[model samples]
Target: MKKVDTNKYTKLTLSLERIRGIITELPHNGHRFVVLYDDKPDKQGYIQTILEDDTLGEQSPYLLETRVYHTEDTFSHYRKSCTKAQEIFPYFEDFYKDIPFSYENWEEVTKEFLED
Candidate 1:
């Protein structure tokens, strides 16, 4: 398990763990607040205890409405009980099943994704 820092955009409303994904070069493929720096996702928003939007809420029966981020291709959200930072480790570990790849740097990669 790991901890995540806070992001300025949703800093006050969400927990620090909720907002930490923007700090790393990891591919945040499935989580809403977790933005992938290179992949160019399109939409970002929050889910709550109750909502009408079917695409962005209620994946788990026990959980309330979950926040979600959507790309042109799909939707994503933080896994229940995991911080955005802790959430990344498992996904990245699976991604790098062998050794490593030359991922582009974070700031520039994110900028490049966002610009597209």
Candidate 2:
């Protein structure tokens, strides 16, 4: 598996209020988000949250999917998938223990990861 660049990704610590703001703007209509961690053993920490949107599929009122992975090492982690925004908070608490909006702050990091 490809390992995350330690120099590029660092542990994120944000205020609870800021975290709440990030969650509030998440579109509940038909978009999803994935919480990712650094794929390093000693450095296992939250890297970024990815948004997954399926706008072209023809389904009857598709629900958003939020996939959370809590990693123990470089290769393994527990997975929790949910659709409701309410269900996502616990995972956020576990990862950040603190606290998104605009996603403007996240765009650069996310794009860099995706492009890699």
Candidate 2 off by > 4 Å: 1-13, 28-41, 47-73, 98-116
Which digits, one per residue and each the tens of the lDDT, describe model 2 over residues 34-69? 333434465444423323343532222222222222
User: What clash count goes with each model?
Assistant: 5, 2
TM-score of each: 0.20, 0.39
After superposition, candidate 1 runs with Cα above 4 Å error:
1-34, 40-78, 83-87, 93-116
- Local accuracy by lDDT, each model: 0.30, 0.36
Q: Among all windows of ten consecutive residues in candidate 1, which has the lowest summed lDDT? A: 101-110
Candidate 2 displacement at residue 112 in angstroms: 21
Candidate 1 per-residue C-alpha lDDT over 1-116 given as tens digits, one digit per residue, 9 for 90 to 100: 21221232322333333333332322322333332222223423332221123253333221222223345544433323322334334433422232232222211122322424
lDDT score, candidate 2, position 56:
32
